[model samples]
Target: MLIGEVARRSGVSARMLRHYDSLGLVRPTGRTVGGYREYSAEDMRRILCVEGLRSLGLSLRQIGRALEDPACTPSALVGDLIRWAEDRLEREQELLERLRTVDASAPSGWQGVLRIVELMHGLNSPSAARRQQAVLAPAEDVRVPTELLAGAVLAESDPNVAGALRWALARAGSDAVASVVSGAYSENVDIRRRAVLAIAEMSGDEATAVLADALRDSDPTVRRHAALASGTRGVTAAVPTLVGMVVEGTNDVEAAEVLGRLSLDPECADRIMAALVDELAAHSADSAVRIRLTQALVEMSGTIAQGVLGQLAHDGDRAVALIASASLRPVRVVGLPDDESCDDAGRRHPSQVLRR
Candidate 1:
């Protein structure tokens, strides 16, 4: 078959077929009387093979070798081709993500577009300092898109950079809340922790709700952070976890302080006092646990806790009794209504005299 016929039948352009000939990938097996190149049946098979390898993303040089080199095995060449295609796909995917992020920002001009591009590059920089600077630099003047910051914050590993990114995300406000919440459900433990941390800094009921949901996370650290943040936000759902933190002595001080704040309301005060007292009773056999619980009671406000403290003062555990007695002294419940009083009457005199 002549080159034109082969081009017509194979869909490989004549010029490309001639180029293949020049590269020795598919040489014409014969020539006509007019010196026109003619391809034999074997040449047609070779042409088909070249097109087949090219379809697999092989370079022209690679295709030439696959067709000509006896040592270049098909398995090895195909394996390299697969890797090369994967690398290209990965790079293209990254580019697509960048474009999508830029599009999401809806930049006002080329300058705005350039700013986002630079910010993205900085966030992904291998240098931790560069990532840190990228997160911090936006504070001065650059306005990074909240979505970008939300994504970066989840993936950030450096403590300083992660903190700065969370600050930036917080400053971005509720606009990034969806992204942060999405991260809260991520399979990655670190991402979930970061998501809760980011949400903790954010205000609004949505952020609070996200933290509330995170309180049940399988990861203890995630649950602990979420519980503390939620308690600070006055989510009543955090009560159980906050109470547990006191018993476990993990961030027990902050947990107690947050519980105290949550107890400012009359209703919450009674519930919190009950929780602490219950935990105190449950851990009665463990002196160290009892001591932490006894100290945690100091964070609670209102006379409801004073009665519990009074009873605890005479407990079987000497350390518990000493700590509770000390806690009972000079104690005043700040938010109790005048009508409200401790459940035990005998303890009332100490509460009354203490209230005075």
Candidate 2:
């Protein structure tokens, strides 16, 4: 067949066919009287093969090697092709996400677009300081989108940068809750942990609802963070986890403080006191645990917790007895810098006395 006929039938442009011939990928098998290139049946098959491989994202050199090298096997080359294709796909997906974030911002003009682009670049920067600055940068005119801040919060690993991102998300308020909540359910433990932490800083019923769900997370860290945040928001469901933290000595002081605050509600007070008493009974053999619980009781109203403190004051453990007895006393001031009375009674904050 003539090159023109082959081009017409095969859909390969004549220019491309000539280029393929020069590369020896598919040379014409013969020539006509006018010296035009002529393709044989075998040449047509070779042209089809090159196009087939090209469709699989093969480079021209790779196609030539694949067609000409007898020792080159399809298995290894196809595997390499698969990896390259995957890399390209990942790049495209990342680009798509960036575009979506920018579009979601609804930039007013090219200047707005450039500002967002710069912010995104900073957020994705390798340097943690740059990422932090990206989040903390002044944006009086151009408000950073909540989605962008939430995304950065979930992905940030550095402690300082992660905190800054969470702060930014908090400032974004409930608008960022959904994005951060999605991260709360992420398969990655770190991502889930970050998600809960970010959501914990957010306010509003929506954030509180997300935290309530997060309390059931399998990861203990996620649950602890959720419990703390939820408890502060008056979600009574956090009471159990907060009590457990006291027992486990994981942020026990803060947990106890939250529990004490929760106890302000008369009904919640009964439940809080009951949970604390139960923990005290459960850990009767552990002096350190009992001591911590004793300190936690001080946060409760003196009227409700006085009876329990009286009984604990006479407990077998000397340290528990001293702490409880001190708690029972009506010191002129508690938790004050110049309250020498607390020092005179050898009383200290639970956090100061317990390492665990």
- How many residue pairs collide in each prediction? 0, 0
Local accuracy of candidate 1 as per-residue lDDT tens digits, 1-356: 99999999889999999998888888899999999999998888888888888898887898886767899998998889888889999999999999998887777788778888888999999999999987776433445678889889998889899999988888885587886788999999999999999889998989988899998899999999999999998888898898898888899989989998998988988888888777767876888888888877877888777877788889898988887888776545445555554535625544344443
Model 1 residue 266 distance off true place after TM-score fit, in angstroms: 3.1
Predicted structure 2: lDDT: 0.87
Q: Which runs in model 2 stand beyond 4 Å of their true positions?
A: 333-356
Leading candidate by TM-score: 2
The residue pairs in collision within model 2 are none
Q: What root-mean-square deviation over C-alphas does model 2 reach? A: 5.7
